[model samples]
Target: MGALQGRIAWVTGAGSGIGQAAAIALAREGATVVLTGRRKEPLQQTAATIKDDGGKAVVRPGDLMKASVVGRIATDIEKAFGRLDILVNNAGLNITERSWRQLKPEGIDLVIEGNLSSAFYCATAVLPMMRRQKGGVLIHTASMAGRVVSPLSGTAYTAAKHAVVAMSHSLNMEECVNGIRSCVVCPGEVATPILDKRPVPVSKEDRAKMVQSEDCGDLIRYVACLPPHVCINEVHITPTWNRGYVAALQQAHVGAGKK
Candidate 1:
């Protein structure tokens, strides 16, 4: 039997990338995964993959940015399963016009809603169920930009991610007593579709060297499977290549030669 056999897990943004990968991994471990996203088609695809692998999945499509939608989803899950064992709050987005000059008020709102507010809504919605059950796990997908300031991720995205990190930690501080553990995963340069929103075009070679979605899925699965007594507060992960570090070194060399 898989470690998570009989557990019920809900994964947001499960249509593609890290969210989709995490859902499949959790289901593989025997969890009945609930997949949610803005679109229905992608969530259906994820469910199909899990079903083919002999795992179970349910597609619950919604715009998580709206509290009403999140509330309804939570109610439905509680009614159907009576308990929630895990929540992967992985839905988020980045804007192409991320810099200060290009950042519009609307863009800021959209990024904040997608990355931070939605997570808050989901976490709160499940906390009651988890508390009643006396144990649960909340894994948040943050970014390295959440740990370190980065121009590449743009102002709004960076700020929103940093807030996500803080929010996850706050959950741990308060909810640990309830036997609920919250973990925030900070990963660098994942080669997901969101990369297409980058202001600068990323080369195929660079994408190949960056972290993959499956890597994160495995990490999340490990976190979820740990003993109930053990809680992973945070994790910082990066590709072995370390593209940001390499770029900084090359820029320093160019500046020295010009001087």
Candidate 2:
């Protein structure tokens, strides 16, 4: 039997990228995965893949930014499964006009709502059930931007991601007493569809060197498989050939030539 044979896992943003990969990984471990995303078709596709692999999945698409929608989804999950064992709060977004110079009020609102508020809503929705069960796991897919300020990710995206990290740690502080664990995953330069939203295009070679969605998925599965008494507060993963480090090196070389 799989370690999570009787577990119920809810994966947000399961349409594609890390979320899709995470859902599949969890299901393979014998968990019944409930997939949620903004688009119904992608969620359906994810469910289909899981079903084809002899795993189980349910597709429930909705706008997670809305608290009412999140509440209803949580309520439905409780009715269908009685308890929620794991929550992958992985939904997030970044826009091309992310810098302060180009950022509009609307852009800030959109980024914050999608990256931070949506996660907040989902986490809040599932806490009650997790508390009742006396044990659960919440995994937030934050970014390296959450830990460091970078021009590549822009102001709004960085701010929202940082908030996500804070949110996860805060959850652990209060929820660990109830056997609930929160893990914030901070990954650097992942090659996902979100990369298309970058102000400057990332080279194919760079994308290849970056972390893949499946890598993050496997990480999430590892966290979920840990004993209930064990809690991994935070994890920071990055590609071996980190782009930020390379860029700094190249810049230093050019400055040395001019000196």
What lDDT score belongs to each candidate, Candidate 1 first?
Answer: 0.96, 0.96
Q: lDDT by residue for model 2 over 1-259, one digit each (tens)?
A: 7889999999999999999999999999999999999999999999999999999999989999999999999999999999999999999998999767888999999999999999999999999999998999999999999999978899999999999999999999999899999999999999999999987898999999999999999999999999998999999999999988998999999999999
Measured over all alpha carbons after superposition, the RMSD of each candidate to the real structure, in angstroms, is 1.0, 0.9
Compute each candidate's TM-score over C-alphas. Answer: 0.98, 0.98
Candidate 1 ranges with C-alpha deviation above 4 Å? 255-259
| Model 2 pairs whose backbones collide | none
TM-score, model 1 to reference: 0.98
| Per-residue error (Å), model 2, residue 132 | 0.7
Per-residue lDDT over 1-259 for candidate 1, one digit per residue giving the tens place of the 0 to 100 score: 9999999999999999999999999999999999999999999999999999999999999999999999999999999999999999999998899889898899999999999999999999999999999999999999999999978898999999999999999999999999999999999989999999877888999999999999999999999999999999999989999988898899999999999
